[model samples]
Target: MAAGAPRVFVSHLSGVAVFDPNGDQVGRVRDLVAMLRVGQRPPRLLGLVVELSTRRRIFLPMTRVTGIESGQVITTGVLNVRRFEQRPTERLVFGELLDRRVTLTETGEEVSVLDLSVQHLPARRDWEIDRVFVRKGRTGSAFRRAKGETLTVEWSAVTGFSLEEQGQGAESLLATFEQLRPADLANVLHHLSPKRRAEVAAALDDDRLADVLEELPEDDQIEILGKLKEERAADVLEAMDPDDAADLLSELPEDDKERLLNLMQPSEAADVRRLMSYEEHTAGGLMTTEPIILRPDATVADALARVRSADLSPALAAQVYVCRPPDDTPTGKYLGTVHFQRLLRDPPYTLVSAIIDDDLQPLDPNATLQLIAGFFATYDMVAAPVVDETGSLLGAVTVDDVLDHMLPEDWRETEFHLDESDEADEDNEEVAAHDS
Candidate 1:
């Protein structure tokens, strides 16, 4: 522990209310961010991930933090609205380090890691681990059960919690990545050793693993998929979006792809196969077969309910396709689509066919990527339907799927950049301007 520094346990820091210099409540601290340092040096505290009124999680760098006491934090009164995005080297202290198992050097007994303490280094702007709070033993007497005793020990007294130890196959380690975005999780998985990556992949549920796989680079996707059992891999594939599944399957060897496809449900396999038949860069190739579709006679109320589903993406939810007869595809006759704006404007009992956007034209299955891009640019649509030669609605291509094909492979890292210091300065100026 650094000398003459106030000691604060991480548990006490979680959920602490943050206030500005004027003593106005800003938000609550959600998590502490830290950068893992090399060698015997303690990890450096980076900042705090704070949840504001809008439920947006944003970063508040330690540089702007003025005080930490009495279950409250005082800031420099500068607030940023943008959400926090984790950098490659950073880790969340509350999510990852707490509730883990560590070895006590003197006792050689494994104890449940309960909480962590960090201290500001003397005369320096750095915060480092000072002590570890651990549960010593099972607090129980035969029939009566109770909580264990807690002990705060020097940071040096614990073992098995270094950067290298993070990969030692503990299920507890995965808790850290749970709150991260799929893209961010994919980046963390990419940096892990092959064995550790497989362990983490196995630990994640099908839906989460599917989301992460879609965000990963193709080679990484294939490698992780290869690690799973054939049956489990198929299940994960089924959970993924049809377009992403087809794209990944298209990258595999024919035999491997066939074997996995054979394991999928007939309906899912059919959707993927339909997508695979088209050229990889064509509308047919990029479209998702499971788009929202409604019969022409369906009521706007019914359409609105389907749109309310949490599973639907913003782009897919923006509109619903109106077709004839069979609710499922091959939707008999391709009628015009109904945009969400129309759905809202009309009464609930109104038929969908009445408000269809006749101005929007559906794309042919054979349309090239360039043509599809132009169509989206010209129509300003988030998603456009794909129709077969007979005018049967096949699926819709979302703008996101198009960007997936168009952007460079490394575009994930380059898409957005936010600097903490710049955000703080902007907020300070905004506060100053408002006062004047």
Candidate 2:
């Protein structure tokens, strides 16, 4: 783990209240889900099993989580309220891991699992088990173990928790392709048999699956999505970019589309619903609702901070949209845009409004695909804000999205190429590891 990566002991998170961005309490963290890897590899943190105020237990994908501060957990407010069902590959940290017996590799001493620590992998949203807190004494109640030694050690120092050495399946396949980019993984999935594609899709964490889905062909997207449980399908959609999710939903049968939409959190569904209200090729339909938004009074430093978010795509981070109030889309009257270059040129304390590029006219929500393409070409802009007739900032359409529409519908399938030798080398290594 990196020195400064966010690390949290599972004990501290027990029963912590989870709140939405609006400060509304949603639930409490009941347990965490993790996937065990083969051999001694640290398990991957999957998501949280939260108990909502309504006494409903739902799974909260860590991708939707924004912060884990003192005594509380913060979310992006886009939760899927479906009951959490454990898969054959998933283990609950609180229920299945704690109080278990594990052995210290160095001295071969058996100990009781007290807690496990998870840390975010550097520069990525993925997290993993990196350390274990154990008690070096006879396993029993807390009082019984009072005199025993307790210490935290690296995950590799402990035995147990990982999958069997002979383990082979979708997760192992996923391990072989762990370093593959989302686009590459999507291509792999695209070429796989339907059963294999669905198997690997089921093994992927929600955020990862969402990213791959965005890169996949529409047919593959629908096939993989149809194979997922309806509740899980809704959760995956919620994790996807709003515009992309909306596009996928539009392609589904009307009954299926409405059902999944209804299954989603209201806040997330509303964004998709709003986008679906527009023509397929229009600016309103193509724009992502989660662009970096700021108020006119926000300083250049603040804009830079938003731009620096690792979650943003390059085009979305190319500029910050300035609005009046209400920082989220359909934000208050559109003020202007502060391109990244302008923010870099100004002092940190300079207000964004003073550096706004209001001279360039914004795109209309109903702008045609040809018009949108022309605007991008004419201004040499990678992204352009879309404003409604009421002057509220709806969202910003990026150049990539415009190109996606203008390209042949089969472009994603046509351009993807998988290196056969790379797969063979990885497969050979996989066989060698399991054979030994």
**Each candidate's TM vs. the true structure?**
0.73, 0.59
lDDT of each: 0.79, 0.81
Taking all chains together, the TM-score of candidate 1 against the true structure is 0.73
lDDT at 244, model 2: 96
What digit string (tens of lDDT, one per residue) describes model 2 on residues 1-436?
3337478988778778899999999888867888888877898888787867554566787766778877898988866654456677777776557655778999999877777899977678777889998888674431123348999999989986652322112532454456767876786577555765776788788999999999999999999999999999999999999999999999999999999999999999999999999999999889988888898788999999989988899999999999988878899999899999999999999999899989999999999999999999999999999999989999999998999999899887663343455234333332222222
lDDT of 2 at 95: 52
Question: Candidate 2: which pairs clash?
Answer: none
For model 1, the superposed segments whose C-alpha errors exceed 4 Å read 1-101, 112-115, 123-126, 133-152, 162-177, 191-196, 415-436
Task: Report the CA-based lDDT of candidate 1 relative to the real structure.
Answer: 0.79
RMSD of 1: 7.9
Regions more than 4 Å wrong, model 2:
1-168, 416-436
